[model samples]
Target: MIIFIDSYTEEKLANSLAGRPGYFKLFYDTENCGCNGVLAIEILDQPLDTDIRISVKNFTFLVDKQQESLFDDALKLEADRSYPSFKVSSDSALYSTNVRIKDARDMASK
Candidate 1:
């Protein structure tokens, strides 16, 4: 699989990885929010016991085995510095989602 991570995202990921070790794992899955089925993205430290792992651009990503069909050969992930959010695009569609950046103090309490 081919995935693109913009420079800003790469920098942020590098910093996060350095400090938190394995704090986040990119994940893609299909979910039904209301009526329509949508792709879901999650950043979690550990993968579900049954999740499948894939590597792209030296980054580890996880996806449920059931969601493998939704995985496209080409995936684009870009970080928009203007909004400080990330956008994901695949063969099917393009969408933007916010990245939840938790403060260190907040995370420490969790």
Candidate 2:
């Protein structure tokens, strides 16, 4: 799947990374949500061997090879500078309107 990140949202993400080595991940967070978990955008420093790369303008997002089917092939990501969450959608339906941004850079890498 391809995700188009808006210019403003991209700027915020870049600032969050702070020039540190990292990549974005379309995370399917199943923690407390349920079997049908909420989606999130995660920033991480480690490159995983199980990732399927989806390239954007200046960055590439990684998705778990097994969970690639959870998203639409073409999607748009948007966010308001005032809020910390994001909205992900496609032509067919709105997947999630308040997808959280989870910065996992501080967690121990696998």
Could you give candidate 2's per-residue lDDT for residues 57-87 as a string of tens digits?
Answer: 8887899988888778999888866777788
Indicate the TM-score of model 1: 0.63
Candidate 1, residues 1-110, lDDT tens digits: the string is 56778777778655555555443334442244554344444455667786777665656766676665665767777666777456777867664466433323234358
Candidate 1 segments exceeding 4 Å error: 16-18, 23-32, 37-40, 95-110
TM-score of each: 0.63, 0.87
Clashes of each: 0, 0
Q: How far is 99's C-alpha from truth in model 1 (Å)? A: 6.0
Candidate achieving the largest TM-score: 2
For model 2, state the Cα shift of residue 49 in Å.
1.9
Cα RMSDs, all models: 4.4, 2.0
